[model samples]
Target: MAPTAALLLLLSLASVCFPAAAEETLVFVTVLFRHGDRSPVRAYPTDPYQESSWPQGFGQLSQEGMRQHFELGQFLRSRYGNLLNGSYDRHEISVRSTDYDRTLMSAEANLAGLYPPSGGQVFNPSLKWQPIPVHTVPQSEERLLLFPRNDCPRYTQLVNETEHTEEVLNITAEYWDFIEFVNNKTGLKNTGVDSMWGVYDTLFCESRHNMTPPDWVTPDVQQKLRVLKDFSFQIMFGIYKRVEKSRLQGGMLLGEIVKNLSKMAAPDPQQRLKLKMLSAHDTTIAALQSSLNVYSGKQPPYASCHIFELHRDDNGSASVSMFFRNDSGAAPYPVQLPGCPLRCPLEDFVRLTQPSVSQDRDKECQLPSEGRDKEILLILALSAGALLLLIALLLAVVCWRREPMAARGYQHVLNQEGGGDDS
Candidate 1:
C-alpha cells in the first residue's frame, strides 16, 4: 500500500507542472489595410471612366484586387499553418469588413485563398465553392469606420473646442484656400469627394494607365495640384505641427479607437485566438495607425498589414511586438512599431497603445447641429409670435390715441371729405 501511494504522488506532481496541449497555445491578431486599387471609386465630372468603363462597375473590386487578396491569403496560410487545422474552425477565427463591395469582396477573395475548401469542400464534384460569411456593416452605420475618430457629440465638441485653438483654426483656414484652388482648377464638383486621396488616386491612375488628363489640365496646374495634395495629406495624417497639436488636444474617433484596442487586448492572455482579420479602406488604416501614434503621408498602400505578436520573455513575463509591412522597402521591408522594442513587453505594448484613452469623449450625440427643418420651425414660430405681438401693440396704441378726441375727429372729417369726393 505504501509503494502504490508513492507512485501515485509522483504522477500527481508531474500532472500539476505539465499543462495540457490545448491550453498551451494562445494567439490573436487584428489587421487593417486599404483595398486593392483599380479605377477610381468616384469620378470627377469629366473623368473618362464611367460606371461601365472597366469590366467591373465603379467602386467594385477589379481583377487586380482579386489577385492581390489571393496573394495575401496565401501569405496568411504560410504564416499560420501550424496553428490552424486543415478544417476552417468557425470559433477559432472571426472576420469583419466595412460594407463596401470592394472591401467585402476582398475579404471573400482572401478567405478563398486562405482557407480553401478542404474536407467537405472536396465533396462537391462540380467544384462550385461553398459560401463563407464575411460580416460587415454599412459604412454610414459603421462605428469601426469612425473609430479613433468617433462621430460622438463629445468628441465633436472636443474637436470644435480644439479647432478654435490658434493652431487648428490656422490649418483650417489654410486648407480651405487649398481646397478652393483645387476646385477651381479641376472643375470638379468640389463637394464631398474632393479629398487628398481622390486627387492622388486620379494622378496615380492617370500616370499608371497612360490616360491623359482632361484638356483643362495644364503642366503647371498639375504641379500645383500635387503640391496642394501633398500638404492636405500631411494635415490629414496629423504630420503637420498645427494638425498634430489640434488633434492631440482631444478627439472622439481617436478615443474610440483606443477603447477598441483595449477591448481586444483585454481578452485573457491565455485564451486561444486562431485568426482575426479586418476589412477596411485606406482611411480606416490611417485612423488605426494614427491612434497608435503612427502615420505616413500616403495611405498604407493597398493590402498593407500591421502585425502584433504576444509572447512571454525569459523572465516568464508577458510581452508583445508590432510590425508594419507597407511593402515599400527594397531589402529589409516592414517597419517596426515605434517605442515598442523589436519584441516589446505586453505591459509596454499596452502603455504605448494606451494613448487612445486620451481621446475618450465625455458627451453624447443626438443629431447634427445643422438640422434645416428644425431651424426653419424655430424661425417660423419666432416670426409669427413677433408679428402677432407687433399687431397687438399697434392696436393698443391706436385705441389709446383714439381716447383723445382729436384723432377721432380728424378721422370723421377725412371720411366725410372722401364721401363728398366720391359723389
Candidate 2:
C-alpha cells in the first residue's frame, strides 16, 4: 500500500517471473550403438551369395556401414561440440566395442568423424584422421557389450520357458505356412520358426544389395518373414520376464552405465572421463531398451544408438536423459524411462532400474538346485558316514589285539610275584 512497499513487491514479482537461469552442466554421457550394416553372418544351405561373395567375407562391415558410423561420429561431434575438446583427448573419452570386426571397425570409423585431426594434432597432412584408442576384450570375456550372453544357463532356461509361452506358440502356428515355404525355397530340411530368421536375413541382405530375391520372396512373403524376424528379436531380448532377462544380460551393462553416471555426478575434481562410448549390436540396444521399457517392438536399425546423458544443476541435483538415434539423417528422439519424466532424476533413474541390475550375474545364472543335485548330496553324505564307520571298526580291531598282549603281560607279572613269594 506504501510507495516503497509497492516497488519492493514489483521487484519480487519480477524475480518470481524470471528467476536467474540455473547453471545446468553436462557431467557425463554414455552412448551404446549397434554396429552399422553388414553382410549376413551366414547364409542358408541353398543361398547364392556365400561368405566369399562379401568383400571381407561374411559378417564384416560394408563400405556403407563405415560411412554410417562416420556420419554417426559427426552427429556426436555436432551435439557435444561444446563439451568435447576440439581434438581427441584420451583422458576425456573412452571408447569400447564388442570384439567383432564390424563393431571394432565401426568404433574406429566413428572416432574418425568424432575427432578428425586438426592443427598440430595432424599426423599426416593428407589424412584427416588421428588414431584414437578403442578398447575391446575377447568376445568370450565380453559381458558388458554382449547381450543375452549364451553362457547364462538361467537365460537359456528363460528362453526355453519363453518358447512355450502362448504368444510364441501362436506365432509359430501362424507362421507355419511361411516356414514351409522357406524350407522349400531354400532347399533346407525342417526349417522351423527358430531358424527362419536366417532365411529372412539372407533374403533381406540380398535385397538391400539389389540382388533379386528368390521368386517366392514376394512382398507379402518378405513382410511376413520380417515380422517373424522381429518376433525372433523380441524373443531374444523380451517376450517374458523382460526385467529378469535384463538382470542376467543387458542389466549388467546398464549397471555399469549407472555407476559411471553416479561417479561423475559426485563432485570429483580428479574425474577425467566425460564421455563413454560402446559399439555393440542391435540386441544390445534392444536389451537395454527392453530393460528400460522403451522398446518399440522392432529391431533396432543398423548404427542405431541409445544415449544416456547425466546433467547436474547449480544446486548439485543430478538428472538423466535418454535419446535414441536410429535414423542417421534425423535428430535423435527423446526416450523417457517408464514412470519417470523425460529428464528423470538421477536417484529415481537408479532406483527404477535397480530391478534389472544384478549384483552377481554369474551367480544369478546358476540354475536352481534340482532333484539330481539333492540326490548327489545325499549320496555324498552317506559315503562320508560309511567311511567314518569303517575307520572306527579298524580302530576297534587294533584295540582288541592289544588287549591279548596286556593279558599275557599280566600273567608273566603274576608268575614273577609267585616265585618271589616261594623264595
Candidate 3:
C-alpha cells in the first residue's frame, strides 16, 4: 500500500475509534434511571406478607432505595460536575419523575447527593440538603417517560398478538406445570408466563428484606422466576415485532430526548438547561433500550441508569454518546449504536433512530385501513340483517290480519245458507 493511503486510513480509523476529547465538549446530558429498591408493588393472595408488612407500605421507597439513588446522584455529580453548577440552580438542571411516591422520592434523594447545601445556600446548619424542584405529571397524563402506554389501540393489539406467537406459546407450554403450581400456591387464578414477574417481584422483595418466602420459593425457583421475569420484559417490548412495538411505546420518549438534544445543539442563547434527569420504573429503561435495539434482555436493576451525552467539537459538529450503568460498583458500559460509530454524529443518531420514533403517534396507532375497513363491513352486514328481520316481521303481521278477515267472511256465508234451508 502507498504511504499516503496508509496514513489516510489511519486518520479515518482514529476519527472513528477515539472521541474528539481535545476539541469535544459536553453541552448537555440526559440521565434516566430506575427508582431505587422498594417494597413489592403488591402480593399474591396466599402470601404471608401483605402491604402492612412493609414499613412504608407496598410500592414505596425504602431506606436502601434512598441510599442507592443518593449514591447514583453522587456518581452523576462526579461525571458532570464541570458542566453543572456547584449549587442547585433550577434553570440549569431539570428533574422529572413519575408521579409514584417511589420515583418522586428517588429524584429528591438523588438531588440531595448531587447538590448538597454548600456555603451560603445552606438554610439550616444541622441539615446539608437543599430543596430542589422535581417536576411530575399524573401517570395518565405522562407520555414522555412511561412505557407500554395503554391508550394506543395498535400497541395493545400488538401485545395480544405477541402472546400468541410460537416462541411465546412454546415457552408457556414448557412451563405449564410450573405456572399451574404457582397458581395453586399463590391462589392467583390468573398466573401466567406474562404475569410471573409479579410473583418474582414479591418474592425477591421479601427475600431482600429477610422475610422468609414459602417453601416452594427455593433458590432454583427464584432463579427460574427471574428468567421468566426478564422474558416478560422482552414480551412487552420485543418478542414478536420489536421495532414496531418500540415505535408505539418507547419511541415517544426517544423522540422527546432527541428533540431536547437538537434544541441544545441549536444556536439559541435561551437554552439554559445542562442536565435533564428522569426518574422512572424499570419498564421505562427497558422500553427505551428496546427502541434503541440495545436492550440487555434482563430486568433493569434498581437504580440502574442510562445516560445520553451530547458533545460538540471545536468545529461545531455535534455527536451523541450512550452509556448504561447497571452495576453500581462498576463503571458504566459504553453502548455503541448498532450501525453507527461509538461517538455517533447527532444527524446520524437522529436518522438511525427515526424508524423507532413516530412522526404522528395517534395516527400510527390507529388500526390499519384494511382492518378498519373489515370492521366497518362486518358492522354494516349486521345492521342490514337486523333491518331485513324487521321487514319480515311486518309482512307476517299483515298476513295474519287478512286471515282473520277471511275467516269472518266464510262464517257469515255459512250462516246465510243455513237460514235459507230452514225457510
> lDDT per model, in order?
0.60, 0.88, 0.91
Model 2: pairs clashing at backbone N, Cα or C within 3 Å:
none
Give the lDDT ranking, best first.
Answer: 3, 2, 1
Cα lDDT tens digits, model 2, 1-423, are 999999999999999999987788988889999998899899888887888877788888988999999999999999999889988899999999999999999999999999999999998999998988889999889988887689988889999999899999999998888788788888889766777778888887777778777667788988888888888878877889898898988898889988888889998889888899999998899888887889998989999999999999999999999999989889999999998999999999999999999998877887777545867899999999999999999976775465545454566556646873222
Q: How many backbone clashes can be found in candidate 3?
A: 0
Model 3 residue runs over 4 Å out of place are 1-22, 369-371, 374-423
Candidate 1 Cα outliers beyond 4 Å, as residue runs: 1-26, 125-130, 146-150, 153-182, 189-196, 206-210, 215-227, 237-272, 313-316, 328-334, 358-423
Residue 109, model 1: lDDT of: 81
Error of 1 at 297 (Å): 2.3
Model 2 TM-score relative to the real fold: 0.87
Candidate 2 weakest lDDT stretch, 10 residues: 414-423
Best by lDDT: 3
Q: Look at candidate 3 and tell me the lDDT of residue 243.
A: 91
Write down the lDDT that model 2 would get.
0.88
Model 3 C-alpha lDDT per residue in residues 319-417, reported as the tens digit of each score:
999999998899999999899999999999999999999999887788787568878999999999999999999976774465546454666546646
**What TM-scores do the predictions have?**
0.64, 0.87, 0.83
- What lDDT does candidate 1 reach at residue 294? 61
lDDT of 1 by residue, 1-423 (tens): 699999998889888998443322234555555666666666665566555655666667767777788777777777778867666777767788888888888888888778877667666767635567899877677765434344454344444455365654565565676566666655666432125457656756555456777765677656656655544444444543323322433233444433444454554555555566777777666656665666665556766776655543334455555667666222114445578666665666666655453432222232335455578889999999999999999976875565546545566556646773222
